[model samples]
Target chain A: MSEQQTVGFTVNGERHTVSVPTRELLVHTLRERLHLTGTHIGCDSSHCGACTVDLNGRSVKSCTVLTVQAQNAEVLTVEGLAGPDGLHPLQEGFREEHGLQCGFCTPGMLVRAYRFLQENPDPDEDQIRTGMAGNLCRCTGYQNIVKAIRYAAEKQTAGSV
Target chain B: MIPPSFAYRAPASLKEALALIDESGDDAKFLAGGHSLLPMMKFRVSEPAVLIDLGGVPELQGIREAGDRIHIGPMSTENEIIGSALLQQKCPLLPEVARWIADPQVRNRGTIGGDVAHGDPANDHPAVMLALEADFVLRSSQGERVVPANEFYFGTYFTAMEANEVLAEIRVPVLGPGTGYAYKKLKRKTGDFAIAAACVLLTLDRGICKRIAITLTNVGPTPLRASAAEQALTGKAIDDAAVENAAQLAMQICDPAEDLRGDKEYKTHMAGEMVRRAIRQALERAKEAK
Candidate 1:
């Protein structure tokens, strides 16, 4: 008999409270409880960044983080990447640059690149590759994904200017 | 993969956390960063009935300068260390090595204390700590005690850390003038565990090795210090012959397991290669320091 704990956290600007088992992972809480399926679980291990999410202003693998650990923390998933003003630049860039084939790794890639671009607003090609190394894309060979992130960086900077 | 059901406590203070550990006894584990423990729990390799979350403890959360040593809080993340101007100016080798540990996301979460207390030879920080001759401060409800990095590890996935004890701080001595360092790791891919890695810290006086410490990663049950290699280079001119002899001595200490990375022979050879590279780089940095 395991005890259940209640955790309250902000997700994509919304406050939500959920009672889950201590063993529940943040990825499961987002997908099963909050119904945010955008964060996928590729490798249960931390190797695959498919479950990467922005927790408390920094990107972390949600699968490796317990839901209880996220109490009072702010989380941003791929579902929150957009605004009231249509798709995010990353979403638009993916479409513009053909960043996905199967699209399994896109959400994680987009979310990670979201944080990556914020960390390094004007990243070079090598920086983009190194920053996105945590997220693995088996399809599309990562060339187009790199192009997509590059496109987003340019578009974001242009919009800011 | 779901971990076994366990009660989790996010204690507000280090005293409360240690009390929880004392109450739970060996069935409890302090969760720091969770990059290492969570993965093992997901694999069903480590099962603890209670998890003491040290994430909220403010006591174990920053790097500070005290006397001649830098006190690194247990909960300090890799990214924090990497971006820490204090550490970058004082202990650049750590931040340089932290960048090579994993990608950006992992660095944002993984902690140096977890890397050391976890006691995995494959983890980069252990060898770096051993090479730096760092000291780990372990605390329990009883009190606090400092353990040197070299005497800490007992075996693979093992350390001198007691069940009731928590890694409070990692106190690393400030590098004096003329010190040089480098961590050379060869992994299959980015974020992968090292196939064979070497961390070298040395001091050179007038182009002769005054002091040197060489440590190998993932080539043994624990991070092995190549004392013989250090001996071979100390007080000797770090020429090609001395470097080659030291690398060979480093190879003699390797007892690696064959995995997806490579076989024993290849890993041993790679260990020597990494040692050679680390020594050469450390020498160059030493000359630059001079």
Candidate 2:
């Protein structure tokens, strides 16, 4: 028997309430039910971080997380990165540094980097590599991805000052 | 890609969770971080009729000192353990070993209890716990019982924990002065399980090895405490020959199953290499401890 329940959570600052099967993964809930396709599911397994999203201020693999577990959780996706004033520094950094080749891993990378920077606002090159190690990018060999995160870190620091 | 349909129960208290599991019977599974269990569910390897999530249980959280031992909640995440100042000061081995478990995302949600109770030999915590001489606190409707790490694992995917019991807390003794430790894991990548890992804890008095505990990961059906290897180093001056003797003794007990990581011969050799490196590093740290 399939058990379903009402799960209420805020996605991108907007509260959402939906009834989903208890087995439904958080990635499917966001992409299929809510139509927030920004969070991609690369490896349905937790190995690939393409489905990464910020839950309660920490980046987690949405594909591995059950939707029911997100009850009353504040989730942040790639769509939530930008503000009314302009694009988030991470988005701008990706564009400026050519961080993407196929762009499939961009959303996960940006979202993870978004939280990672908060964890370490001004990280060194080694720190950025280690911090972003969870999210995998087949293309660009991670060279540009590292550069993109570094670029965002510098921009965020300058703006804060 | 998706887990089989199952009833989900989120109990707010430990008592409620225990009762729910007891009522659900054997088909019910306790959900911790869900990193290990969820993936198995997705692949249809495990089909639980009920999932009792302990995430809401307020009792299963935090790290604190209880007398001479450190009490660690099972729900404490790897990141939380890494960021814990108390753990860093009292038992630095835990935080050091936790950083090498998985990557950032998995570590954020992965719990120490899940890693310990999962009974997967590939998991790093079992060996570290064995080396640290830690104890597991299991609770159920009947009562609570403590199981030492060395006596916990019986074989692959099997442990001393009863089906109805919940891992309430883990108790590890605070490392005394002049103690040194290292967890040397050789993996394919950041998130990969160790091919053959060695966890070493040693104390040196003057130039002689005072006490030592050596444990190996993924080299047997269960985490193996290399008592023979420890015997080679204890009460002896750790030199090049003594270190080599311990490494060979550690390799003697390895019965690793052959897979993508390596053949049995290669894994056995790597296990020795890890022991060698860990002992050298641990010795250096022991000397530095003041």
Best by TM-score: 2
On a 0 to 1 DockQ scale, where is model 1?
A: 0.86
lDDT of 2 by residue, A1-161 (tens): 79889999999999999999999999999999999999998988888799999999999999999999999999999999999998999999999999999999999999999999999999988999999999899998998888888898999999899
- Per-candidate iRMS values, in order, are 0.9, 0.6
DockQ of each: 0.86, 0.93
lDDT value, residue B242 of candidate 1? 93
> Which 10-residue window in model 2 chain A sums to the lowest lDDT?
A41-50
Query: Candidate 2 residues B222-279, lDDT tens each?
Result: 9999999999899999999999999999999999999999999999999999999999
TM-score of each: 0.98, 0.99
TM-score of 1: 0.98
Q: Residue B289's C-alpha lDDT in candidate 2?
A: 89
lDDT tens digits, residue span A40-116, model 1: 99987888899999999999999889999999999999999999999999999999999999999889999999999
Per-residue C-alpha lDDT of model 1 across residues B120-196, encoded as one tens digit per residue: 88999999989988999999999999999999999998899998999999988788768889999998888899999
Candidate 2 Cα lDDT to native: 0.95
* Docking quality tier of model 1: high
Worst 10 residues of 1 chain B by lDDT: B171-180
The alpha-carbon lDDT assigned to residue B167 of candidate 2 equals 98
